[model samples]
Target: MAILTLGLATAGSSGAHPDHGGGREDFPGEGVADGSYKQHDGDEGHLPAVSRNVTLVGKAAVTNPSGAGNTGRVADVTAFGDYAYLTAFREPTCENTGVHVMDISDPAHPTEVTSAFIPTSDGSYAGEGIQVEHIDDSPFFHGDLLIHQNETCPGETPPGANSGGISLWDVTDPRSPKPLAMHVGDFTNTAGGLDPAPNQTHSMRMWTNVFDKKTYVALVDDEEATDVDILDITDPRNPVLVNDGLDLGAVFGVDQAAPTNLTSVFSHDMMITKVGRRYVMNMNYWDGGYVMLDVTDPRPGKVSLIAESDYAALDEERSARGHEISPEGNAHQSELSPNRKFLIGTDEDFSPFRIVAKIDSGPHAGTEYTATPATDSKQIGEGTTISGAVTFVGDACAPLPAGTGTALVERGTCTFQAKLDAIIAAGYTAGIVFQNHRDDCLSQVSMAAAGPIPFVFANRFAGLRLLGVPGVTEATACTMTTPATGGESTTVKSVFDGWGYVRLFATDVPTKPGKAGSIRQIDTYAVSESQDPAYAGGFGDLSVHEVAMDPENNNTAYLSYYAAGLRVVKYGKNGIQEVGAFIDEGGNNFWGVEVWKDETGEQYVLASDRDHGLYVFHIDC
Candidate 1:
């Protein structure tokens, strides 16, 4: 069994990136605190248990029989005709729990038609993003084709195992889905530093272009070394690699040189849409932001750059800190309006902080300083100013010495929470400032909990300056401020202040024959005021996850607003407006949502909750 650890960063810049720490770690026994699982307590625990015009039609507790040590969290869901396809991560035991096929013909009660698992010599399982495509009058095979990415955790791969890519299956027999082929790709460790190149496939999207008379599948390479891989699946059984390394930088007309921060340049997720005669692919490049490429000519294995968007402009304030560039913002996912006039992008920064400090007295009095907030520190208030003596904890990365004094600013190891606690125990009431251990700029720190007092982090130069000051060593005093409240406030501020919002852009030329021709910035849309702090667990309080367009209405869009539940927005000449929303009473942590029309022509919204099972809602609008 694996013990879930809440301290481990689970939130990705976007939903597509693997869990921050990389796959699930194994530990003994059931219900152990392994730091892998997130505590769904408080607002994240349960939904409100109420409903509006939206009614929960059908649900399947696939993850039930919990305590198996595996992540019961359902990854993604896709529907076709009378069935729905669901994929789940491997169990804690590293057992394969592949795909779950549901008979959703009756929306109110979904029944599992069949469950499939991938066999691995090492016991690791398969599952991540799953999609189904229908091929009619094809030269290869016919009926429904199921394709799912085969993703294993960072260290979970067996010896001599090349275990990551897309798995193809024939689901014509829903009760007996047969595995057709497994296209194994490259593998690269995601634990930071370079280990290898060409990472494994994380998520994929496949479609048959009627106009081009061919089928294509695009998969994210999951590592920083590679961006995306395009495959030709015209012969479902024999998938061929079209391009192993489709460089987004080259396609976007940017420098092909490797970025200093490799994580920022990798491809995390992608979606393909047909706008008029052009087949466009919208890629969510981690730090690169939103990138659009023209894939109209896939046969040539070449993609044309359309328009690329970056959030560097938003980093001006952060760059001013220590005169160092702030890390790239996470551009996790991107979706377009039904009319393709507006592009909705999501930035996924799990834990973010803004540093604010000022010297209250001494020669440095009135001198302002910028320090980042520790993810584990309690939120500081604007009205509170903590003053104390300047002290050093210990050597960088070493344990603090016993008998440390109180109310003193201690500089020591970069990120040892235990050392920080030791200083607090010695009666440090004012605050603590940690010095960066390496030459790189001081980045944000993720802690398990907020300590007794405020904890601010300083860059190397700032730390050296403080150490040199006589007053600072004797009786240094400083004021610290953060968002209003503590826990809830930190959660809200981290997202709102960070990069996880929507960015809309226009192309240099018209995507449609009669649409506008020039490129320009469109208006940005955030959650409505109703989601303010006053309303606990409101839509505006959470980060935006995935967005889906209403097929029938070019102006309508549906969003899975993580903890905010489901929201419906309308965008057009009048601008974007929130037309409707439904926050389940049970407390919703919605991950992905899709809008589909049934055989009877009635439109419904299918939403996947990280905690709850599948939810089917009637789109009244």
Candidate 2:
């Protein structure tokens, strides 16, 4: 771990942030409605967020032209020249879910370039993984390029709903998008699934490897072992999948039955840039921490690990709340500094609170458990009384027999939500689904649990322990085909832990192209209220989502801090220090952040507010 330091985060009781205002984290395509809205409550909910040296230049509300309503339907965005392209999120009309181009000539009044709207398939949507890149040296194509991930909307499929994989378009002209490649790397939805979907393309980045004189795209496989994808896009029209399903566990040496310091491990987001002549990729794999790879070749077998970060047994954020607990892994999104000296990452924990259980009566009784809320459901009441009675078990992939209690199911077979649905029909109130295979054998991953039902997504050992299978350890391999067995009374109880925050890695530069380096963890940062239990209950999410480096200065990093608004921090020899912040009147729910420096070299921070549209801010101080 690197040198640890606490950010000058504002506290929960300070009245600087917005009231929870009954708002909940609404995932893009899942569309889980916030059920906590209270009527006529207080002034804090509508109060203007505290502003420091940041100034709002202009704003725009993504609207539905059909008038059906498109409130908060924006996800990721990218900027090039005087225009920016935005991705649609859970659009009111799923069919119309596409990319919107914004004319930013007049930063004070940026408007959507409707004519440039790049729509997806008939019944699908996009996620937070849209990127625009310029392949300066590629011979196949010469202009600006855009790539997007297509995900099928929740519920029924609308006819030939062919979705999944990455789509490419030439956006040299913001208004007239020329299709270069459509759904090039899609995968089947199920086993031997006929209709393919681009479900795994959660977050991706493109770059031109100077060493190879070619271009490539590295994307996340959200739910599969083929987690890291590097597509050769030297020919914009015909992309080649250089590497398929490269499992992190197999490559990182943490996936096997060894005891890993990292808890949750999966590729989520990535940033690619150059260090001298070497091309490096900084990947944020949940609890696996930040990993830097030498991707100079941008091909399958050619990639090699350069460095991986380690987490503190009790990181700064956890200790902020005075808890001696370990860091809740969420290494979400990150990028190395332009100077190639350090990397800044944001750990997004929508559900700040975590669930840790202990074996109550077995030989392994009193042992600590690895757990995280699989569902974003309502809090199971304040002081933690075990909610339901009895416990049932089965591999949740199938419809289990009726059992009116908590359901203990195995992972895989179907979606987490589908498993919950099956158990609910069988009268189960909550779920405890464990890892069914090696890919997820020992990790505690956060789920896009789609319903109101609460659930606990556990590691493989947790499931076996509940089934009364003794001698289970981190090294025990899981049987993918075995269904867990347990009566409605397996011994277990739940307790809450601290929220998620941020990590800072000090860069250890590699020598040259295809060389290796060690990127070490030097420190961690989070908003003061993030670890405060008082803010955990409400005030929206006090956690940071995404960040962008100031093109004007590498030490300056702008953060899209959800309910706490936009935060401006400067990283120095000591650590990161917050310099400014902003939350609009009525509060702001910022999602994605991007720094755009126009031809004039003036840098603007474009923030996507989940409740509102987009807000452009400039760091004045």
Candidate 3:
């Protein structure tokens, strides 16, 4: 068996203090109702709240606190030796547009080492993905290399600007990182007419093997019909393209299907791990679930597929949920356990809902309804029925006739909250139900405030049924029901919504010649036991975003539970157990988490909050 070991060395400590940068903020305002918290202007003094064992040792805002477009929010972080590299998702026009280098010899207070940005003439930026590795023994180059993804949004590329791809930097001198190479993709020609908007790299990883005597980086092309792009970086100054693109469907005999949720066939993220002597690449193929590839022989174009996960059956089941299918099941990202016995995968479902509306009374009585709760509508109680005369209000975007009936039925337009407010002011008290203006089904609606009365939504077809009911007029009485139990109330039942959860898979490495190993589904972990009223009948309040396994302990996995904060879980012969958690009271939209060790061999959790800045925590368990 090939036992792969990561050769990481600890660096001597260096004491340094934080330095503040001064400049006029560019881009948009810090906070503009982007669903997360408003950016606190010049509030770098704010620190993340933590549990008893976890400490807020070091804190720094990479971007100008007064700027806009994710200015102060740190996107990702990577630790190597005594320094930590952080990526920020700020506007291209901002001064701090690239990776922020921090001297972490002193964990309590990380000092700014340097700031590095991609060398571009048209004012490009870098931040999305980053990885650092030592290549001292390589024949072509020897030193520390920092690789980061250069991502551009659709139609945001400046004329004559280099297309998005990967950028390599030599950080041997932590205080001054020098550019090594810039690799861009060909956007003019894309497979299956897939649009490579903004032409950029979505995610990437660097890998090296002593026995193979080669180093490579895998890049994900975030365009339709595009696949994984592999590059040989043995010579950091001159990266060679080994594979233009590796189409998993064509190579592994797998077929593509229509996306049910947010999942697609496009490659989102990939991780290369050494299992024994052989290296395997586990890819999170959006809707494709998890795919395993044999990259042991990563010769320019000789990679082979070991096994690809099958999610067609799962997709069929999700499609059966009708138009209200939750977005919880789309495989967004994944990570393998330290022991290599299990693979932890996460589905990125940010917008979730738990709305249950049923038709009460009339010919359609007893018919169950799937509706979205108004962003600002008040939560209805169990056994609470709103029965009143049905009155049709014109298109909600425009001014409605004065004093429309109490139970208003309006067509969706503008904002759900705005429509509700207008009707309520005109004296509509019982409730409101908005029908879809488009022919397509209404998936989910974001209501900003819960109005004074209950509110529900229906698709275009359901609206038609309600409008055509016989004997139904402004005086016709209809009722809406909320479950009596299981939801927020003792009698109210919670409705299921969203498609975010974690799944585990197991793989056995081959030990002898002519012997083949097997990969199969093992166990799964979710927030099903959550007692939070918000996720009652939904997919739970915790939408597992990304996971990082403890390097020292294979059984422990740290998860960035969006909204639920950080969660520590352990899995082994005893099954999965919740070991610890730290939920920031201020609110947490954690997108990434990494497990790093200090010189004393103590482990710590580094998390990136999409709304706030970076958070450092010491795991007690």
- State candidate 3's TM-score: 0.65
RMSD of each: 10.0, 6.9, 12.6
Per-residue lDDT of 283-339 in model 2, one digit per residue for the tens?
Answer: 877656788887787655777888787666565656655555555566788977878
Per-residue lDDT of model 1, residues 1-621, tens digit only: 321111111122221253333212122111111113231454544335445546666676554333563233555677777777666554344444466667777887877663443233243344446788788856888888988876554344334444557778888777677878764444434443433323456678887776767888888775433357777888888777677557776555432222222223567778898877777888877666677777766644456767676554323323322223333356667777666776766665433332334444445544434344444566544344444445544432343444432223334333335545666666554344433333222322223335756665443334434444433321222322111211100111122133234445554534542232332445455453322323333222355667777777767777776656787777765456677778765466566787766788777888776555577888666
Model 3: lDDT to the true structure: 0.55
Candidate 3, backbone clash total: 23
Positional deviation of 399 in candidate 1, in angstroms?
Answer: 5.5
TM-score list, all predictions: 0.68, 0.81, 0.65
Every candidate's lDDT: 0.54, 0.65, 0.55
Candidate 2, TM-score vs. the true structure? 0.81
Q: Mark the regions of model 1 whose C-alpha exceeds 4 Å error after superposition.
A: 1-53, 65-72, 90-97, 114-128, 136-138, 154-159, 187-198, 210-212, 250-265, 299-301, 310-329, 349-499, 503-519, 529-541
